[model samples]
Target: MASQYSDGTLPSGNIGRDFYIPGLTPVGGEDEGTAFDMHARQTRFNFSSNTTLSNGKALKATIELDFMATPNGDERVSNSYSPRMRIATIEYDGWLFGQTWSTFQDVSVLPETLDFIGATDGTIFVRQAMVRYSAGGLSVALENPETTVTPFGGGGRIVADDNGVPDLVLRYTLKQDWGHISAATLIRQLAYDDGNAIDSTETAAALSVSAKVNLGRNDVRMMFNTGAGMGRYLGINAANGAVLNASGELESIDSSGGLIAYRHLWSEQWRSTLSYSWFSADNDTALTGMGVTESTRSVRVNAIYSPSKELSFGVEYAHAQRDVENGLEGDMDRLQFSAKYAF
Candidate 1:
């Protein structure tokens, strides 16, 4: 496999929280994490070509390989290898196998943002071991979830759980002279079956409608999406008590949210995006005595500029607050900026 860092492409970074520049290839392929905080990050290369086999039948193959850096900044060969075959089964009729985005995600409606956190939460399942079929712009997918987690501050035994199981999705799309429109629904099961013995079976669903509008010199696009789900987990713990940084000590919670965005291309040399999102989790009824109920809400706005097709930059401001009833601490805030170049 050959690695090409420059191709004016953005590899998918929906697997984790990492803003990606549209001009640069993803630091790694979409299969791994791109966040700087992760203990490991991967970079991949791909080489695909076609050849004629036995009976004049043309056969095609793609070789993909990824490189990873350890937390200690060490690179090892033992940790890297060629990607397995079967990411797709039959390419005909839009049938897919191995790994790919779920039908539930309507990426066309998403805005271009430099903040990794700004991408839809649905992108995380882009490629998984699964099978799917599509026809007449309608697609259905069944695949396992790609779970991820990070140790906050790297000291406590407890961690934020982004774990989920293989989910089922159904999607429909309509294409027009200007652009396209899409909608989807989904259901998933969570992996964590602990804490208060609450239900680990989670159901996630989303709805969205968007379109591209052309107005002579300027082109505009917009999207609106909302989703809801449940899982046994903790997003925020209050600073009220002498908290033991141990697992099974925190309360689990449920959450729901929505996102909206707008993009305008002023000209060939200038463009930008404005986006807003809010998320809130329900308090744990079982942990009523634990002194805290978990919930959170946040909103953000961003402006992205593309000086040229090869270079891009962005700035963003966000305000977020998390509240836990009778719990450890109150709330916090976040602000971010980013830039990238594509070869």
Candidate 2:
């Protein structure tokens, strides 16, 4: 179970608990007070199998689940949530299928923290269905695509599921005795249709790099990503993929995000990490107006203790801030504690 006590309230998705988010952390309101909550939604389990094929090749399958997306029941009642799929995959002969982490993200670059996503603001955190092929250190795949857009004056948001093209990704990794490094690219066509005269598509591309370097018992992890129309692929969808121009045509948005973290071992069973993350969107005020989010950032520190490989406890403190194009800003401070047992 995990618990958090914050100086400010969180946005919806209490399922996410108190995990830090860039643009959504604070919306700049005076309704601030002590906010506290606890949940076990991040608890998860997995099932896997490996078998030999008729040709003597190995085939493996995995299905994992957690209740992060289950509708929270009334705490006054059952307070039980159902399971949801996190990853389900099949791999054989250098080929993989099903839903998993996006090729654009390096799972190893994720930092260790009590929050659901440690490096929340500047990580390429995405998971979706795809077909992938791997050879040596190179892998490529085409993934699911959806576009989020803001109207001409930024009244609200429009999630356009009218993409005519899938997102394409290519990644390569380098591993050595010290650590590992990875770089990837994503290409997609952002499309939208209002069934009127507003049907169009815009092509956009992005680049991401991540690495982990080991220094004896201490280590460092980092990631950087930038592109046009990055959209939901970066910083937990902190920015939109595109925006509708006055002509009702699609125009890709420009954005960048990155993170860095350092971990130190203090004793056999104790460790600590310090990290910082940020996300920025180059929104055209003429089109998006002053109400949309412009940038967000956060800093966090955590300490963890593990008496054994399967049992661990952690505590983290995080400070996050959000800014809008119109100069409105809000910041929050949060402290969290968690305990976990893994089998």
Which 10 consecutive residues of model 2 have the lowest summed lDDT? 1-10
Q: What is the C-alpha lDDT of each candidate?
A: 0.43, 0.87
Predicted structure 1: lDDT? 0.43
Write candidate 1's Cα lDDT for 1-343 as tens digits. 1112211122333222232211112222233221222322333355666667678665554545433322233224343333343233324335665544345545565556655435332121243456678789888888665322112222222332334556677778888777676766656543333365422333444454555555554445544433443221111111111121235232223344445566667668666666654434453334333333344444556666778887877666654443434443322223456566655
Q: Tens-digit lDDT track for model 2 on 19-108?
A: 666766656566674566777878999999999999999999999999777466566757677888999999999999999999999998
Q: Candidate 2 versus the native: TM-score?
A: 0.95
Candidate 2 Cα errors over 4 Å, as ranges = 1-8, 11-17
The regions of model 1 sitting more than 4 angstroms off are: 1-90, 119-127, 145-166, 189-254, 287-297, 325-337
Q: lDDT: which candidate is best?
A: 2
